[model samples]
Target: MVDADQTFVIVGGGLAGAKAAETLRAEGFSGRVILICDERDHPYERPPLSKGYLLGKEERDSVFVHEPAWYAQNDVELHLGQTVDRIDRTAKTVRFGDDGTLVHYDKLLLATGAEPRRLDIPGTDLAGVHHLRRLAHAERLKGVLGALGRDNGHIVIAGAGWIGLEVAAAARTYGAEVTVIGTRPTPLHSVLGPELGNVFGELHREHGVRFSFGTRLTEIVGQDGMVLAVRTDDGEEHPAHAVLAAIGAAPRTGLAEASGLEIADRAYGGGIVVDERLRTSDPDIHAAGDVASFPFALFGTRIRVDHWANALNSGPAAARAMLGKEVTYDRVPYFFTDQYDLGMEYSGWAPPGSYDEVVIRGDAGKREFIAFWVKEGRVLAGMNVNVWDVTEPIQNLIRSAAPVDLEALADPHVPLESLVA
Candidate 1:
């Protein structure tokens, strides 16, 4: 059990780390809470970095998890711009990079999160090439693409995932010519399936964003240290003033690996292995957010989710577990995104090839619909696009896990609440 007088250390200053500090204070923990972060800024949310924040609709101050004064007010120590050299797990100390400072902790939480995956194409290091994983990256992109009018600048995005698509929409709103290249035929098809993925693709196409499906980026062409275009495996080159490589992210697990924590099996993306309670192999340490590959009770499998909701929910759960409380972090996975006029909320988990059929309740062509992925008549997952106020019903359907009538589920007249009834 963690004593109130002992020090508690949290690594990484993302949403997970901020929430852990919030929870500790709320739980009346008087221990010294030190938050070590590589970024100089206080903990802030990342979703807006791509959408509203990048588009200039949201202010910088609004994205922060808490004001800078909150940490001081709550007695949480802020260690900004410090790189963690190593975790001396045997000695229960975290060594700093520059000055060799050792911060001792009776209990530790690892929320190092994940880093954006980089493309290894020839000109990836060019000046106009960018990746979006931090505020600094988004700021750089805003400087490059913010003021361009329609067709004034050509922007090539190398991935069709959520980040790529969201930035595409934002760039389009600024009137830039955008082209998205993806190995998959449709954007988000792996998660939402081809039917819904096609909806997103068509939506983008209608707004003048081009697509190069089933192609791989072979090289980023450049001269004078600035990107000029991208060449694909299909022998086609697309002109570009700026390029964004939104090819997804990989869990930052180097600290866990070095500290000898059990790395999750490769099947689970090789993150730090944790139980349902978010406890790592060592009782004195715990990991949450994207770095922890935890056993998900609802899906009956181990998984690591790199979404905003998981980080928001799991951070507090890990804090409670670290306090020696018996708790299970069993909340269903959820995530939401906004691109162009389309807004979507998805709940539950059903990986690609897991669901046998997708049931639609509204007009997909019109962009207002609720889609459900069912396996053996049980609703494994559901998503509502541009459809509001039914998230509770969708979540309830997934939690119940009861077989539903396909005809009724597909009928718009049938209230979602009645399907589970």
Candidate 2:
């Protein structure tokens, strides 16, 4: 029931929102479009904020997905420095926090992404305790490094996720003293299994970075309103001038919940529920990117993946659904993380506790290898650490769902292509 010239309102100007705007225009839908973003800057790359941006290797404009001129040229109206206070579902309107401007939309897209989780302990609000999610956060952290010379600067990262490790690597590049603490037994254990995780643990240890595993941070000790120490669960404390909480992020869905939408328990983690075609409970609304937990047809389950690949692919899927085209947003989930000059790629979908066998095909000790997760003789997922080219064959195997020879996969002499059939 939408008018030909109706407006399309996209919430959250991250990758999903910005790309969705571009895709809509490419699809020949020249309707009025508006993008809402709270951040002062336009859409930029988030991954580099944890790596190159922190290391001062890339400029601010380099991180942007597209320049402002691109938006103007495409006739996309951008509402930067604007916050969407509420969503009026009955009226199909979005209210802005400043001046309370209400925008009416014939169709809506929820692309509000995630924010870095914060710690609730005392002294967490201190000046030196930070979370690296936005450009402002990266700029502030980089400034902290600039003031304190790399040799004596101490960084305490509270979580063992990708952000924590990526930042640790960047800090180490500058010869800073880095200490990574995690609640788990091994760093990267949640994603990579125990065996491979032990290798990652050893690799970090080889560098001068101290890894504190199986410990919980109790409090942040500060002096003159700035962080000075990080206290642990075991009554141990470490000197720290800077502290970062890179513990995972949760979906930002306050707007959808306030609009009387059906939210799930995993909503905070996986995000709003949608079908294979990415349609929400209300057919008039569609969601994509990190904010939508659409069913995974390949795994026959629901999973929320926060990665560049997922962000790129999900927008097209949602756009197809918006065009009333029948489509399924099901594909093997993929992601990667960069740490200490290492390029790690993870692909395909794996069920919980589903892998009965894992084949390692290279020297894991040298930081170059590929591990295959196989369940019931079927290749489910593959991970490569510094072994970039092998991923192509593994991806083919996943798509074909072919049976693998365990012995062949474990042989370093045999090429990965041998198992492609």
Candidate 3:
């Protein structure tokens, strides 16, 4: 039974951490709930950092998980700008980094999230170099893009993953010249494979975004502590006013590591290892969001996804489990992207080389289609581009794991639900 004496402390106040606190209260927990964040801003969603907020399509307040007043209204103890340096599993307490303040917990949830992978090359400390993993970063980039647009400046991006392409689209929208550098041959090559990856590459190119595929940034040449240009591995120099390191993000696992939490393999997201119920090595401590790598029953492997949907659903799942409810977080991996006129949703996992082939159900040339990654006559994953209301059937097909007729799968006339049946 929960009581006024009981306390639940949540670390890392991103969408996952904020949602977990909300879920705890919704599930009728009257205990003291403390939500802590390293960032000064209130808990906010990450997608808008690259898509809407940076594009000037969304306002500053639109990205928060809850209004500044919601925490007070809900009686949730909100702690911002405080970093939890050490988690003492034995003492059941977390110590603050700045002031060394201690907070005890009956149960603790770590939703530490992820940090953008930094470019290892020199001049990263230059004034114009930026990373987009936080609200402050996006806010800075938004202003930089506006200034670049006004000054007719060029921005060189150091990766062609989702963040790179999304930032490219936003930069182009602001009339700034964008040059994208990637080690892979196509944009999003690791996620969508070559064929569909080509589509995104072409999309950016059509919007006047330059691609330096198969190459990566080697150095950020700067002057007076400001960026001047970037040099690539191929001995080509591209002049730039700003540089964005969109390589990807790594899970923030330092606190977990220091606390001696079991960590997963580096190749598989390198996050804190958690069981099916989101319980860590210590039963009193649980994990969620990008930091927790839990066993995925559907894939029969442990996968840690850094998508917004994972943070959206996993937080509540961990909260429910913390409240002594049975929870199996087997939600199908889901992610979406909106670039220019194209909006796409991808479900299930189909890493590179894992699928036999990718089949497209509609006209890819028309910028509309459903791409399925098939493995041994079974649909391993599906991506619907500019399609509507098909997420349910697509997720159902993935869970079914039944052999499907490849021909019927590619036919636009065939109903996806029928194939699942």
Candidate 4:
């Protein structure tokens, strides 16, 4: 039933869109495939931007999802530096670029990703103000960090979330003065809750990262269009040669909205609403990655995950589904982070207030431990810090949904596999 005459079009050129193109060909679909990207650069991964690439540990070319030649080799037509601004759902056609080149698609995939939330304060247009969502931004910030390190300059970050903390670690490693500001009592309070989040706060403190918790940025005080310092709502000002707005990101769904697609509200992570098969309200159109809010049967909720793991897996799942294969995307949510000497892998979802108790196994002080969020004795989520080879067992325990012994769960001597029935 593979129609060689039909054309499949994918929007957004990030990891998800790229993987979808690869999957289409792998499924033996002898059809025309077109991939459109707004970014001029080839589709690349975003993690290294705040991790190794920013830290000078990784090369520039290592971030791309595939070699420049892969698209042509796989017969995947790539349209870079262009955008599909309008989609005529009635006609099943998309218009792109200034010329409004129209392309008819038998099935369309929208992998449009999210963008960093802009700082609401004044002086954000200053030269030294930066956000690390795109490669161009990271390339600029990398040099800024090196210059700050050489001159012993200071940087005041506006948020204590993942991007803020990761950038702070890189800044300190580069020998720049660092201070982090957050509205939460502890970092990652929304995701990890206060008990475990305090661990990260203390780790950053030990590494010379100053914290101004329970507050937010008020204004970026600058002179001559260059950031000089930042003022907080608490009436305190910190000298800052540079300022990073690590607030958060919002899903890019203007195209979906313009096309009158069903977009979920902020409560559901604000993305295109997709079914278990990754099909949107319009049956012929699909969504994935940070832009797809789908039904997660295991979590009993329609959730949207804005992380690397979701894009890496959901893209192919959606691709196979688009190819007329039955697909139920119930893969356990997974994500990892590396800051300084601590490397952690987190699986499953346990939003704050959703879990009753958090059990710790191994030595937390040494950063070699696994923390489980449990509700009524059922494992809800697990995060392993400086631990290895435990993701499978952690995910298995969550999937089993069997109540576990609190004492055994907290004991390092017990094997995680034995507890899952």
lDDT of each: 0.90, 0.81, 0.93, 0.93
For all predicted structures, in order, the TM-scores are 0.97, 0.94, 0.98, 0.98
Cand. 4 TM to true fold: 0.98
Q: 129-157, model 3: which lDDT tens digit per residue? A: 99999999999999999999888999999
User: Worst 10-residue stretch by lDDT in candidate 3?
Assistant: 1-10
Residues 1-421, candidate 1: write the lDDT tens digits.
Answer: 3345799999999999999999998988878899999999889999998999999899989999998899999989889998887999889999988799999999999999999998986988898888999999988888778645544989999999999999999999888999999999889867787868998999999999999999989999899998889999999999998899999899999988998999888677768888888989998999989888988766778888889988999999999988888888877788999988899999888878888989999998888999999999989999999999998899899888889999999998999999884
Tens-place lDDT per residue, model 4, 178-248, is: 99999999998888999899899989999998999999999999898899999999999999999999988
Candidate 2: tens digits of C-alpha lDDT, residues 240-301? 99998989888887888888776656732558887888778888788888878777655556
Question: Candidate 3 has what TM-score?
Answer: 0.98
RMSD of each: 1.8, 2.3, 1.2, 1.3
Better of 2 and 4 by lDDT: 4
Where does candidate 1 have its weakest 10-residue lDDT segment?
142-151
RMSD of 4: 1.3
Number of clashes in every candidate structure? 1, 0, 0, 0
Q: What lDDT is reached at residue 233 by model 4?
A: 90
